[model samples]
Target: MDMSSISRHEFRLEFLVTSLLFTAFCGYGLVWIEELVISEHWPLDEQRFWPGKSYDLNGYLDIIVAGKEHPQYGRPNILSLRYLDEVARINQYIVHNITVPVDLEGKHYEVAYTDLCMSFDWACYLNDHLTMLMPKSRWGNFSGPIAEFASDIINNEVNITYPIGWRGSEPIYFGALVGRPHLVDREGHFDHATALRLTYNVGNISYIWRKKLASWLTNKEKPPSGESQMLSETAAGEGQAHCCLV
Candidate 1:
């Protein structure tokens, strides 16, 4: 073979292999890191963590509700709970601002009393999902980030919650759960992408790890501000679609 032809073929082969590895790397990152923060289980663990940062959370929360932030709605203040009884205090702080009648109609709901303090990532998820799910409601389809988290936690296969359809299909249908106080929505998935955020939990943010974990994380939320169903479940009946299409 001519040198030019051989070089061209080698470069193509190299590019293809590199792309594959890059893709895998991204996927790993997404599963291990991004999903945890934005998907199903991070907040659950956080809820538990917040209560136990000191001697406070010992009996109140032995299993879940760690690190959960009871941030005041509308206002930037966070009540910061250490016990379940604090729910009353938390309610007084930011509960009123939460959608009172609990409707997801044309009106723009407040940023959510608890949601007011969404990390940058959480904020992006809300905007993207709200625009994606609610607009689709016009076409008889609905989905969003909160919906994604709820599904991840309660989907039948995972069985985080009892009874197949206990949590409804999408987050909007169950927005009240966020305000319910006793709801236990939690799951632990540390495959690769979820492991990305998990890596932070475990402490590893190198480029290589981030690259592999990125793919898993990307599934956590869409790029934000698009009108696609994101997943392929039929509207209304499918409830919440769980996991990735891949």
Candidate 2:
């Protein structure tokens, strides 16, 4: 008797259900797309690498060894210090009050040098940038911990020792290892100059972005078990410290 009424009620219920389902699917798709874009935006994989302009970290070990062996420039050492200044200049850029945003393992970090300096103490022109970030004081005032912390930075691991205020008489040291390395000639002579010329204002944004994307994708595809290993060397020069944004 009321067949027309029943049909109308069923059509309304069906349309409402369909609309709700469509809305839910659209919302989920938007979220999924956003995440995908983010993943592509900041990849944190270990397999990616972006060489720095002006001074690519070429021959870093040689530079450290040279800085240790030969205090004076133009002196013949195991490694050549001819191009060390260029690299030092680039490292200086890291602390030039510029900020960099980095994404590692799904964590967002804004890295900027809050404070830094260049010290030529201990008979070597060490980029003493990291010294400012060292913890003021610690339970033990030893050099071993300081050395280890520097190693972690060179190795590209986040192991900075940020203690409270300054520790009296407990100086922290970080050896320069993140810049271009010193090269040497076969005849035990410091080369007059380097083959590559450096220039500031390079295209670093796209370069860094590509690297971050690669790193992120690589990590998602294959997670890393431990800290990254970078080519490094030790020197007798005065140690320097570097700081990173939280």
Candidate 3:
């Protein structure tokens, strides 16, 4: 080969080698960090490490509720949950303000309340579903810091009670069951790009494990038919649910 051609070839080869080295180094670092977190930091046994029913969970989502700040009909605060593969079960909680009225009956009356906007990320699963825990509280009132609400969400304590309007009915207290989907209205609002980036940035190591587990789960089974039906129903219940598409 001519001298100039040889030099160009050498430069290309060097560049290729440098790129490969950088990539490998990054990959190795990711793996090492993951190992450290799982083993030394938040270590658990193999069985406890990945709990919950196995599913592919290609990020199907359900709504929990919408809280409005003004307690008005048109405005809504959004709260939602989604299965982001097997590694992360995400909670997106939005708050709103509301007011409900009940007429005084001779014998019975109803108590109504409205939602008040907050941000939260409740933790439902740990180490890609190894262990699950509930947050201490669900939706926080608008008076607190958003980060506190987010911390509560990650801890899995997101049970919110919103008053749409006052109706004369018996009072019932309740809590959410773990592994159960939220009772969402028909519409949903989310920033997919933002959530995805947040997931990776917050749990980049878990993402690596999630991809592998998700592949295995997908091969093992399919999403439940009942769940599919429920999701479809939500889509159909848009107007009744008072939701806006996002």
Candidate 4:
């Protein structure tokens, strides 16, 4: 064959190979993106944990519980709610039953209201932000199967029969207070107010909390008072602190 013809034939072969490689890369990229989106929006069948059925909380001592880990490293299929009445009742019971420590006397000790309020605000902000991305109805409501599924879960999990006494909204207060010590450190004094103030400008608090929960579960072991239990709680708490500060 002549030089011109041989060069043309080689060019065509090169173009064909390059085109196949480019197409394969694009296809793989699309599939990866789709998998990531699906994992975030939908829970895997194997990781769908129901409280009474798949897992039992009776083994744990703490009132707040963490769900099973997500298979895809995405969002876990768990709903978190702070029951106002139930929390109040528990606080009241603790105040009446437990004696105050001598060192904490005369201090204006209070619940971690700043953290609580911030958490609530973050949740509201996230909801509003995500809702804007979703399709809505004429009545300013989210519409679709995902919305319906979320509504059903919330309704089933939350006890709406509780009485409501307050109507007006209150201003969010942010300040330091003598509050409960760190869960993992009984002797060490680390209040929520200080923690919140330190981590205020850091990353999302929700993600930090989730990381903490995951650490807690992974490090948890039999016999709550065991070394492993303490290590787990410490790891989780440390993760929250580090992530928040970072």
Q: Count the backbone clashes (under 3 Å) in each candidate.
A: 48, 22, 29, 0
TM-score of each: 0.20, 0.20, 0.24, 0.22
Tell me the TM-score of model 4: 0.22
lDDT of 2 at 129: 27
Cα displacement (Å) at residue 104, model 4: 23
Give one digit per residue, the lDDT tens place, for model 2 in 1-246.
Answer: 699988888789789999999999999999988767755754432223221211322211111212222345432321123323333444454334345587789999765432111111212223332233223232234467687775544444332222211223333221222223243534222223212222112222324422332242234233221221222322212121111100
Candidate 3: misplaced stretches above 4 Å? 1-5, 45-63, 67-72, 75-246
CA displacement after TM-score superposition, residue 86 of candidate 2 (Å): 34
Q: RMSD to native for every prediction?
A: 22.0, 20.7, 19.8, 19.8
How much does candidate 3 score in TM-score? 0.24
Q: Candidate 4: where is the Cα deviation over 4 Å?
A: 2-9, 32-203, 207-224, 227-246
Candidate 3 lDDT over residue span 115-200, tens digit each: 11111232233121112211224233344588766675544442222212111232112222122223354322111111111111
Report the Cα lDDT for residue 70, model 4.
43
lDDT value for candidate 4? Answer: 0.31
**What lDDT would each prediction earn against the true structure?**
0.28, 0.33, 0.29, 0.31
Error of 4 at 103 (Å): 23
Please give the ranking of all candidate structures by TM-score, highest first, separated by commas. 3, 4, 2, 1
